[model samples]
Target: MQFVQQIPGLLLLVTLLCCDSIRAQDSSNMANMTSMMANATNMTANATSPTNVTNATMVESPMPAQMPMNMTQPQQQQPSIWTTEELVTDLSLPGAPNATLDVRYNDSLQVTLGNKLTPLQASTAPTVCLRNVSVGCEPPFALLMVDPDATSRQNPQFRSWLHWIVVNVNSTEKLHEGDQAVPYNGPAPPKGSGPHRYVFLLYCQRGRRLQGSELAPEKRKNFNLAEFVNKTELGPPLAGNFFFAENP
Candidate 1:
């Protein structure tokens, strides 16, 4: 009929130009999704600002300095002084009938005896002497004579006799017959004179006592083996003195 009524008005003008190009591509994809959600809400408000959180805790970085802790060391030294002069020479004479007496002493005869000589006995033996040398008191004692009945004298010149004399003995106290004054005497040696040599002498004191005269005519002389034999000019009597003997 007139080209079939102009083909239904050119198929209703190509279906209204494909519904206005699908509403202009859905309004250009909803304006590019609202400009990418406004650039992700302005980069999440510049990372929670506060000047980027105080420049991340003021440019952080600092901590270092600590060294010196160690110390302990010191101790050593001891010895000032100690001596009993060999326990006072082993407590003055300890054994051996004082073995061949020579009781050594240096600072000029510093004797030390009395460990226990029965304490200078008298009725039983001690009383040897030569104290103040003699005086009105009759103190010129001299008796040390080891007897065994004076060695069975048949006139061995009446054998040993010296018996009890004693004289001033305090020399720093040591003669002990347990001292009530002095009393213990044992070894009466002259029976055969085989063992007799007792000597106990200890004296030291630079000065003192020597008045003489106790029957003084040079003190009734008698003990002479050539002028009172020498043992280093035996002296010291004014204050400190000691003597004891037992010869056979």
Candidate 2:
């Protein structure tokens, strides 16, 4: 009888122990679920936020930082060659040159504004080219070569010594074909004098072609290009080039 009573007590204690273990496990499982739910809620909030979304979408690129707002820089403005050479102030022209004038004396000697050349190098006549000629409406052209700094830049009493001139060129390539107003004279800057600027000017002949007379040597001294252009109604020069020459 005693043994049977003991067995019932022992069974009750065992049942209590089993119930406690199951309750602890259930509490642990509930804690884990709560943590998982908090993590999922944080992820949803981040996904919905605009700032977070933008940060995730943006891709860092090297080119964008280097380039301007527009894909290219604003034409990267360069200083006009005409203005740099002070052609406007020196010649008293209305504005900058309208077109390019290719002035090549020889295969070895090509000329641009402000280019330096020896007096002996620029001896021959240059082949002038106005390649930007309009179609059908080809106008006659004129070229005037002058030395603005005749004696010296400071003492320009013999200013604008006309070295060469041509008038009424129908074709762009046929500069030699035109009437030679003055023959080509090579630059002869006196020794000890500074560099002299020799300007090659091209004018678009409009209205009527020039029937010019033989120019005397005395008249070549102090030649006024502006006055002649106005007299002949040749209009402003379309293009021009210049080079600096100094005696050896």
Candidate 3:
């Protein structure tokens, strides 16, 4: 016990050295902790940054392929007025004309599908452009203008009164030169009758010509268009246009 007591000075010196070394080691550990915390803060900031996030998103997912021109793009179609109206049934058309039938009167009044007109306004013959109106008619065309609504739209007693008919026409400039099945007659709706629908049809004759003679007055009344179309060997109508007329 006396020998251990004699070594107390050496033990005190060792304790002081040990404490300084521990302080040094603790300071070093604190500095390392601060450095690690700063590194962690920088990593979090970069992860949240827009540029890094965008870069990460780009790396994770590739771009999609561009759409082809023929896919769904070419499926879009132009609108047609004939297809919108009930006259498609009377005309016995397979489809509305790809090229519209444009009818223009002398007064610059136009008939487009189901527009209204007075008996006097449509008294004179109109200028009808059939087939591809933007270009012109190439094939021989047969035109038939008739009143399915003869007396009134409801009654239709005197049904399908033939107004005009021209067959084997190529040019729009001279419809008179074409074979006239029936001379042009102005619309005559009976007084008190509400309105009458006059339909004009154009059938493509292709290369063949129809030598239709001038129709008798009796043949004008009850003129069966569908039967005439079948008898004449004309297929579905190429184009059609109609307008309403009635007595005031």
Task: Estimate every model's Cα lDDT from 0 to 1.
Answer: 0.34, 0.78, 0.76
Give the range of the ten consecutive residues with the poorest summed lDDT in model 3. 130-139
- What's the CA RMSD for each of the models? 22.1, 7.5, 8.0
Q: Pick the candidate with the highest TM-score.
A: 2
Which candidate order results from sorting by lDDT in descending order?
A: 2, 3, 1
lDDT of 2 by residue, 184-235 (tens): 8889998877989898877777746777464334577888777777877777
The TM-scores of all predictions, comma-separated, are: 0.19, 0.65, 0.61
Best by lDDT: 2
lDDT string for model 1 (75-194, tens) is 664321111212112112222221112222222332233221221232243322223332222222221222212343233243323322233333322222111312224445443444
Q: Rank the candidates by TM-score, best first.
A: 2, 3, 1
Candidate 1: residue 136 Cα off by (Å): 64
Q: Which regions in candidate 1 have their CA more than 4 angstroms from the true location? A: 1-12, 48-50, 55-248
Backbone clash numbers for all candidates listed: 9, 0, 0
